[model samples]
Target: MLDLRSVEIGYGIMDHARNQGYATETVGALIDWAFAFASVEQIHAECLVTNLPSISVLEKVGMRKTKEVDDRIKWILKRNSVNEA
Candidate 1:
């Protein structure tokens, strides 16, 4: 089980998995799993602003860019938002 409130999602593709849809698929499933609990108001993830591929995956998984501090971009997936989709 994951504690959505405190959990941070991190993902990276190995050389063999690069250019494939595995990262997106895995993040999508994790988002679904994170939002499974009623107490999970939102899920958070962060990536370096320079990581365009990672940013793309987060966006594709329904996470919105909520904050940016220095080189990091923070994304959030709200439970209510996902439920409405």
Candidate 2:
């Protein structure tokens, strides 16, 4: 799920469909849509530290790692800091 000030988007794909780049594509597309239409200044995501694939997806979608607390890592994609593909 991605959360901004007052808007949030969430998704879940079955285990069998994991790790095929589907999450990355979905996240990227959503980010694009959000930045284009939403009033939020940044998008945020949280993932378990052990979830490498999820981490990759966040980075691929232009979210930078900002901080970590215990087993979770926090990521943020700012409107002005988006990395163009």
Please tell me which predicted candidate would have the highest TM-score against the true structure: 1
Residue-by-residue lDDT tens digits, candidate 1, 1-85: 3363645688879988877899999998888786676676788899999999999898887889988999999888877788554
lDDT (C-alpha) at residue 10 in model 2: 54
Model 1 RMSD vs true structure = 3.1
Query: Each prediction's Cα RMSD?
Result: 3.1, 3.1
Q: Please, what is the TM-score per model?
A: 0.85, 0.80
What is the TM-score (0 to 1) of candidate 2? 0.80
Candidate models: Cα lDDT each: 0.82, 0.78
Model 2 over residues 1-85: C-alpha lDDT tens digits? 4444424445666899997989988998888887886577787788899988888888787888889999988887787887553
> On a 0 to 100 scale, what is the lDDT of residue 5 in model 2?
49
User: Which ranges of candidate 2 are over 4 A from the true structure?
Assistant: 1-10, 83-85
- Per lDDT, the best of the predicted structures is 1
Weakest ten-residue segment in model 2 by summed lDDT:
1-10
* TM-score computed on alpha carbons, candidate 1: 0.85
